[model samples]
Structures are given as C-alpha cells and as structure tokens.
Target: MQGTVDSTPVVTGHEVAAHEEHQDLRVLGLITFLASEFLMFAGFFAVFLVFRGSHVQWPPEETEVELLLPAVNTLILVSSSWVINLGTKAIKKNDLAGMRKWFGITAAMGAIFLAGQVYEYMNLGYGLKTNLFSNCFYLTTGFHGAHVFIGLVLILGVLWRSRRANHYNDITHTGPEMAEIYWHFVDVVWIVLFSLIYLLTLI
Candidate 1:
C-alpha cells in the first residue's frame, strides 16, 4: 500500500491571486495617469484656439510663418521617432549594439530639429511681443522645443546606462518604453501645431 501523495506546490492560491491583482492595478494606474496628462494638454489647446480666433487671420495676415524650415524640422522629428522605434525593437531582441546605434541616430535628429527651430525663431519677422500671431507661434513652438531638449537628455541618460547595465530586455524595458511614449506625444503635438500654424494659414 502506498503512502498519501501531495501533488500541489508549496505556494498558496491566495499568493497567485494577489500577484495578478497587483498587475491589473498597475495597468489601471498607468492608464489613469495618461488620461490626466491628456486633459492638461487639451486645456492648453483650448486656450490657443481662443487666442487664435482673436487674430486678424488665423495665423495673422501681416506676418507669415515660414513653412519650409518648419517642414524640414517636422521631417526630422518624424525620422527621430522612427529611429526610436527601431531602438525599442532592438532592445527587445537583446541587441544592445543595435539599440545604441539607433538611439544615437535619434539623438542626432533631435539636435538637428532643435537647431532648425532656433533658426526659424531668429528669422521670424516679429518678436514674441509683436502681435498675437508671434506670441502664439513662440509659445507653442517654444514649449515643444523645451520638450525636445528634455527628451534628448533622457535619451542620453539611457544611452549611458545601457553601456553598463543589461537592464533592458524583452520583459523589462519600461524606461525606453516610457521615453518613446513621451517622444511620440511630442511628435503629435508638433504635427498639430504645424497644421494649424503653417498649413492652415495658407488657406
């Protein structure tokens, strides 16, 4: 006759349930945080629209925003987003070298975009205090430029850390993921600004 057999693992059912609940909580928290951020940006957009309506032309009849330079900068930003996407994919595949190369290219593109922004600002016929158009143009683009600067710093920090730690992998690359999310947000903001401030002005 055989003795009694114990087939179950040492862990309790409660422990497994707790772990799943914690994961679900974290996901919900992240979604809530993103929603709040969306609302804040929405408020800013509303204010901009109100101010824009006060202008003679949507972007000002007397002063025109140069489409050529902004167009180039927009292309650069879009390319940077692409590079960061590649970098994220490489990190998932555990290809540190590929990640580093792509991130570096992305950083370079960001710098180019920033430089173009400065050139456009300098060449704009009006200063920030000139009129409603100038104020809106500077405020919107300046805010976005500041975000680019911050993103650049973040990318550089990631590059430096990646050299020493193998922290990014298929299952754990949250830093890069968050950075990409922020970068994409910045890109989308610029696209909206370009359409409203540049393209729509022509019509």
Candidate 2:
C-alpha cells in the first residue's frame, strides 16, 4: 500500500536567508538615515558650544533653566531605553505578551518624559527669542522632543500591528526591531543633550 504524502510546503533555507538579507538591508538603511540625523545634530551642537564659549554667562541673566525636571526626564528616558531592550529580548524569545508589556512601559515612560518637558518649558521663565543661549537651548531640546514624539508614534504603530495574528514572531519581528533601534537613538541623543544643556549649564 502506497502511503499518502502530506504535500504541505515548508519554508526553505534559501527563503530564510533571503529574508535575513532583506532585514539587514533595512537595518543598514536605518543606520545611514541615523547617521545623517547625527550630522545635523552635530552642526547644532557646534553652534551651541560656540555660543556658550563666547559668552561670559552661558544662559544669561534672564534665562533660568532648572535642573530638577530635566534630570527626572533624563532618568525616565534612560530607563525607557532599557525597557525597550527588554521588549526586544521578549520578542526574540517569541513571547508576544512579554514584548507588549515591556514596549507599553517604554511608551508610557516616553509620554511622561514629554509631559515633563512641556511642564519644564512652561516654568522655564524664558522664550526662544530671549537671547542667544535661549534660542540654542530651545532649538536643540525642541528638535530632540520632536524625535521623541515620532518615536512614540512608531512604538504605538508596532503595538497596533502586534494585535494582528502572526504579524510578528521570533523569526519575523523586524517592525519592533527597527522601532527599538529608533527609540534607542532618541534616548542616546537626549543623554547628550542633557549632559550639555542641563547638567553643564545648570550645575
């Protein structure tokens, strides 16, 4: 008696290799984009350092940048970076629920940091046109805040997609991976910004 064959197709090694190659290309493209972004920020940093070096008083008399709120925000972002990594680890283990939890925490942290930034702005007792330092300070922090907002949106988009069936698994988690990378970039940029604009200037 001839046995019946299952006839179901399985994913081939070549297909897996091709998918990995595509993912690598996507990551490479993201890195190139981030490099350009870093260059732009570098330009702003140079301008800020030049202004700070030239002026006797870094922030001037009228501008007052407090340390408490920005320090808290920095802590929130730095911790969120770790949380997003946990999400990455979860997805690598094929744990969808775990990934969602960690990413949700990260998004909440990002929201809190943004709210803190807004509160800081309201109480800062200065404006963009106040002086050279104020202008540089606002421009640099505002640009970084915009990136944070974008990162939040990206995270939310990934969460929404994760609700779909089989949208992401251990082998097919590129969306979350890319979002994590962007979030990490945003966090790193803030660390640099905090060190320069807040820590060095205020304390």
In the predicted model 2, the residue pairs found to clash are none
Highest TM-score: give the candidate number.
2
Q: Estimate each model's TM-score.
A: 0.81, 0.88
* Winning model by lDDT: 2
Model 2 is weakest, by summed lDDT over 10 consecutive residues, at: 17-26
Q: Name the lDDT value of residue 30 in candidate 2.
A: 88
Question: Given candidate 2, what's the lDDT at residue 68?
Answer: 83
Candidate 2 residue lDDT tens string, 1-203: 26988755565676775665423477778878998998888899989989889989888878868898788889899999999999989999999999999999999999999999999888988888988988999999999999999999999999999999879899989889999999999998998888888888755
Q: Which stretches of candidate 1 lie over 4 Å from their true place?
A: 1-34
lDDT of 1 by residue, 1-203 (tens): 26868656555797775665323244345556657765765666677778777765676666678989899899999878999999999989988888889989988999999999998888877889988778777887888788789888888887888877777777767777676767777788778778877787777
RMSD to truth, every model: 6.5, 8.4
